[model samples]
Each structure stands twice: as structure tokens, then as C-alpha cells.
Target: MNILQAKNEIKNTVQAYLSKNSFGEYEIESKNQRPLLLIGPPGIGKTQIMEQISKECQIGLVSYTITHHTRQSAVGLPFIQEKEFQGKTYSITEYTMSEIIASVYSKMEETGLKEGILFIDEINCVSETLAPTMLQFLQNKTFGNQKVPAGWIIVAAGNPSEYNKSVRDFDVVTMDRIRYIHVETDYYVWKEYAISKHIHPMILSYLELKPNNFYTVSTSVDGMEFVTARGWEDLSYLLYSYEKMLLEISQDTIYEYLHHEDIAEDVFAYYLVYKKYQDDYGIDDILNGNVSSSIYARLFNADFDERVSVVNLVMDGLLRQVNIYSFEKHCTDLWFGFLKNYRNHMDVSYVDHVKEFIALYHDKLQAELLSDAQKHEYEFVLEQIQKVNVDASLDSKSRFDCSTKPFFKQKENMESIESDLKLQIENAFEFMESAFKNGQEMTIFVTNLIMSAEMALYLSSHTIGIYEKYKQVLLIGSQKARLLDELAH
Candidate 1:
């Protein structure tokens, strides 16, 4: 299975476990709950999937690397205590709570979520002294004498023995005590994630051309040569920051992430082409339906790889519009909800809810907890709320009209909006028709655009006239038509 499939499987397993056990209830004498073990190569998103599961399930997560712990930390330190056995008093040994278990309890207190996942990474790479304790933790679901709290699920992950020399293969008895899953790298699966995450377009276009380079691990005289999904994602963030600062991204900068020299050079060369496409075809003008004939001429003259890079650039622009419209629609809905509640439910009080919301915002603000970007969002939401309240002073219908004016304006201009999106789609199709001729490139382009969670959510929620028109544009050609038909089922 790929990372996406493994993510779904783990989510389902967690959901089922929570449901069957009533959110962590189990009898000590009954069958012991088995931990989930994710066995896979390093940097294939095993740890990331666990975090996603935690967020989707709305539960707390406490992650630790067992290799970072010693035997004392893994099972806690021992202390002497007095105990009475019958008539005589005797000294007894007791252990403090394991740091790992203490972290779980601390997260529960902070998040107020009793049920969650305790994720231990590099479980199979523990030190020799801690190996027995690791087995005991997995099989018994306990650290020394302190059992894991009810309602918490245990999940452990480790790189395969081939990936790490320190990795120890689990015995059959230990393996039988867990639900083990194996994950492999798949470009197509990661591509969808990359598109949704808005990974660097340069990386995306490069990977599109050389999908085989997505995951590689080789040993050479210099030591180990490797590239992993984690490496690309981390590098994407750095590139984005560098671009924001208007800094030149040299080949050395790329090689820092992609260790393979040849692969790095290939990607750096493609990145130059990708950046040239961005400049030559202004995405802003393209989005505004002001595309020049010279752009189309250049597209026709370009080779296959260049054409693919152009397609990636255009698709990136279109997705940006989708993201903007999605956010606007969300704000519009929030505005409408506020207006409706304020007018129709005049007798009822929203004081408590409003106070709670304001209190939460102020708490975050005063604690200096919000990042600069998050602080900007917090201010924007407050501004919107204040604007709506100010509009409430007008007459009932006038207030309603004022509050929903932007939404109504957008609704009234659906035709023009649809026309712009349709033009962008047609422009892409025209290039695809002339450049590729066989429609394979067009198929991949449209598939990348439409097969995203964001796109699916937009289509499902915004079934208005403009979205339907945009959908038609996406489903125009035979290749896209077939793809849409398959997705519909």
C-alpha cells in the first residue's frame, strides 16, 4: 500500500477501535488490545500520516522516538518505598511514571481529550538495553507497572531493516500481538498530496518529468546517497522562503536537500525552465483572461517538456483562483449565518456564544501564542464581525442587503466569472490540443487539477451556476470527459 492507502487504513482502524471499546474502555481480564505497527522505509510519510489521523479524529497526539530514550527513561527510575507484608514492614521498589506515558497524560490535560494516539517512532531501532522493554510496552501496553490510560491507542513505526542497520526484526510472537501495515512509495499518490499542499511548482514540474527520481537510496564511496519525500517537502519550504526574500536559489541550495548530484542538476535545470515559463506567461494576466497571442505562439513552438512546464504553470494559476474563491465563499457563508441569526432570533440571546468566541480570540492574542500569519487572520475575522455588526443598525431589509451585498454581487456576476474560468480552461486545452496531439499530457493536466480534495469540496458545496459552468469547461475534451465520468461513479 501507498502512504494514502495506509493513512485511510489507520484512520479506519482507529475509528473502529474507538467505537468497539467505547472510547478506551476494556477489561483487564479480557483480550488485550493490540498496538498498530507501521512498517515502512524512512521518509515515506509514515509519521506525517499519524499526525493527519490525529487531527482528523480530533484527538491529542504524543509522539516520541524510542531510540532517543535510554532504559531508565523508557521504563522510569526506581525508588525505595516501605510496604507491610502481614505483620512485618519491608522495603519495596517502585518506579516513577515513564516520560513517554507522562507526555500522554500532559497532552490529555492540555487538550482536554482523553482518547488519543501515543506514537512512538523508530520502535525497531531502540538500543539493545531497551529492546526487551520495547517488546514489553507493545505486548502488555504498559511502561513498567503503569498501564497506558484507557481511551488511548498505541501506534509505533520503524524503518525496515534494509533501510537501517539498527532495525531489529520483531519476533513472530511480538508481530502477532499487533496490527502491522507495510507502506511503499508511489509518485501518483504523492502527486495528489503535493498539488493539495501547494508544493513548489518547480519541484512538481521536475517530478512530473522524472517520476522515478521521487524516491532513491543508494550507497557509494562517499557513504550513502539518498532522496526521500521528506527531503523534497522540506526543500520546498526553503525555496518558498527564499523566493519571498528575492534571493537567488543556486544549485548548491538544491543539492543541500537532494543529495544526488545528477538529480539535483536535472531538477535545477528544469527549475530554470519553470521560472522562465512563469515570467514569459504572466499568471496574473492569464487569470484575468488577457492572454496574448504571442503566448500561444510560444506554446506551439515549445518542445514536449517545455509544454508540460507551461501546463503546470497555468494549472497553478487556475488552482490559485479556486483557492481564493473558496475562501471568499466561506467568509460569505459566515456573514450570512450571522445576519440570519441576528434578525430571525431577536428574542434569543447570542451573548454567551459571542463572549466565548471573543474570549478565545483574546486568550490566544494576549498569550502571544499566534504566529504573525495567524495574527493577521485573527484580525481579519474580527474586522469582518465588526463590519457586520455596524451594518445591523440599518433597517431590517437594508441591514440584510448590506450584510450580503458582496455575496449578491458575486451571484449576479456569475456569468462573467464563469466566462473567465472557461477562457483559462480553453486556453489550456488549445495548447494541449496543438502541443501533445495525443491528449495524454492534457489528461494528466486535467487529472491533477480536478482530482484534489479542495476541488471536490468546492464542487460539492458550491453547486451554483458558475461552478457548474466551470465544471463543464473541465469536462470538455474526450480525455477529461472520460476522467470525470469515471470519477462521478
Candidate 2:
């Protein structure tokens, strides 16, 4: 299975495991519920999805890499205790709470969530002495003498034996005690996540052009070399940052993230080409519906790679505007919701009330562990709310009126941005029509927009003439292809 499918499956399993009976006890007893074990290659988003699962389930999360722990730490430190047996006192060993177990309780207290996922990474790579303890922990849901809380689910992950020298294969008995999922590298699945994350379109385009390079791991004379989804995502952040800072991205910078030398150099070469294309073409001019004849001629004469690069360039620009619109809409809607809720309170000290609201939201967000986009929205909302600077001495109405200005201006600016975005969409279509016409480039442009969550939303809400027309063209083309395939069959 792919990581996304694994995520959905794991999420469903977690929900089902947490479901309660009429007596409020879990339907699946804690001891009866086998732990979830994920086996996959390293850096393929195995560890990344745990937090997402916890957040989606509205539960607490405690994560640890078991390879870092010694047997003592994993099972807790043993201490001497006195007990009476057969009317005689004897010494017995009792262990303190394991750090892993303690963390679950701490998270439960901090987040006010009784149920959650305790995710242990590199479970198969634990030290030799800790292997038995791990098996026992998996079989019994215990670290030391403390069983995991009733509502909590235990999920463990590890790199496959081929990926790590220290990996230990579980016996049949241990295997049957848990449910295991094997995940492989999947570009399309990761692409869906990467697109939502707004990974550099250059990376997306390169991967689309050379899907084989999306994930490559091998041993060579120089040593292990690989390119992972994590590397691409981190590189995307660096590229965007460097672009903003006007810093040159050297081949060494690409090499730093993408470990596979061949793939890294190939991507760096594409980066150079992309930059050159950006310099050669005026994206702002295209978005404004002012296409020079020379530019149109260059595009018309360009090859498939050049055309794809240009399409990606335009998409990068479109994504920028659409993301801003999304952020604004999210922030404004949330802020406006607060305002609507606070409207019933007509007393003084609304500023303090608003401040409390912001602080509570901030604290809750820390516990919820939202995705990158949502985190940005929440941060922006809090910042805007803080900057409102309403005079607390004034009456409630006056204070509310003063506090509302920030979102008011934000909403107005959002409207103006939407207008500009609509014009840009129409103009983008016009450029595609004049230059690429009904070529695959048009299909690429329309298909990508339809795939994007924000772009799809924007397109659905606003009826741009050329955009709507191209969408119909795409629909008809898809139907025709399907019909032709049917006839051929």
C-alpha cells in the first residue's frame, strides 16, 4: 500500500479501536486489540503520519524512536521493594514508570484527551537486550508493569531489514500478535500530499517527467545513495526560501537534500533550465493578458519539455495567488466566526475576552498538531487579532467596532485578490489558447487546476468564461477517450 492509503487505513483502524460500547468501555478490549506495526523503507513518511492520525482522531500523541532507548529505559528502571510472603519479608523488584508510558499520561493531561496513538519508530532496530522487552510490550501492551491506557492504541514502525543493518525480523509468534502493514514508495500518493503542501512545482514537474527518479535507493561504490519524498519536500522549502531571499542555489545545495548524485544533478540541471525559462518568459505579463508576439512564437515553437516547463511556471504563479486567497479566506472566516460569537456580549472588557480567545486558540493549536497550511492560517489569525488594539476602556460596542477593522480590511483585500485572481485565470486561459491551443499543454493546465484543492474551489465559485470553456473541453475530451476505449475493447 501507499502512504496515503496506509494513513486512511490506520485512521479508520484507530477510530474503530477507540469506539466505545453503551457502557462507555472500548468495544475491542485493550488486551484483545493487536498493536499496529508498519514496515517500510526509511524516510517514506512512516513517522510523519502518526501526528496526522492523532490530530484527525482528536487524540493525544506520544512518539519515540525505540532504537535510541536502552532496555532499562524502555522497560523502566527496576527498584527494590519489600513484600511479605509466607509470614516472612522478602525483596521484590518493581520498576518505575517507563518514559514512553509516562509521556502518554502527560499528553493526556496536557491535551485533555484520554485516548491517543503511542507511535514508536524504529521498533525493529532496538538493541539486542531490548528485543524480548519489545516483544513482551507488543504482546501485552505494557512497558514495565504499566499496561497502556484503555483507550490508547499502540502503533509501531520500523525500516525493513534491507534498509537497516540493525533491523531484527520478528518470529511467527510475535508477528501473529500484531497487525503489520507493508508500505512502498508511491509517487502519485506522495504527489497528492506534496501538492496540498505546495511543494516546489519544479520538483513536481521533474518527478512527473521522470517518475523513476521520484524514489531511488541503491548501494554504489561511493556508498548508499537515494532520493526520498522527505528530501524533495525539504528541498521545496529551501528553494522557495532561497528564491525569496534572492540567493543562488548551487549544485551543492541540491546535493545536500537529494543524496542520489545522478538524480540530484539531473534535478539541479532542471532547476537551471526552469530558472532560465522564468527569466525568458514574463509570467506577470502573461497573467495580465498581455502576450507579446515573440513570446507566443517562442512557446509555439517550443518542444514538449519546454512546454511542460512553461506550464509549470504558470502553475507556480497561479498557486501563489490561490494559496494567498485560501489563507485569507480561512483566517477571515475564523476571525469572523469569533466576532459573531462575541457579538452577544454587549458588556465592557471585550478586548480581554478577545485576548483570552486568542490565547486559548493558540494553546489548543499546540495540542491539536494541525498540518502546515492550517498552522499558518491559525498563526495569521492570532497575529491579526492581536494587532487589532481595541481600547478596552470603551463600551463593548465601540471596542468590538474597533477590533473588527483588521478582518474587515482582510475581507476587503481578499475580495480584491479574488478579482485579480479571476482576471489572471481568464488571461492564463487566453495565453494557453493562443499559444498551445488544444495541445496537451491545455489539458495539463486544466487538469492540474482541477486537481488542486484550492484551484478547484476557486474555479467552482467563480465562473471565468475561458476557464469554464476549457473545463468543458477537458470533460468532452475525457468522455471521448473513454468512449473510444470502449469501442476498441
- Which residues of candidate 1, in runs, are more than 4 Å off? 20-31, 348-353, 359-379, 387-438, 459-489
Candidate number of the best TM-score: 2
- Candidate 1 structure lDDT: 0.74
TM-scores of all models? 0.84, 0.91
Report the poorest 10 consecutive residues by lDDT, candidate 1: 22-31
Compared with the true structure, the alpha-carbon lDDT of candidate 2 equals 0.84
TM-score, cand. 1: 0.84
Q: In terms of lDDT, which candidate is strongest? A: 2
Clash totals, every prediction? 1, 0
| lDDT string, candidate 1, 160-228, tens digits | 888899989889889889989898998778887888787888888788777889999998898888999
Q: List the residue pairs that clash in candidate 2.
A: none
User: lDDT scores for all predictions?
Assistant: 0.74, 0.84
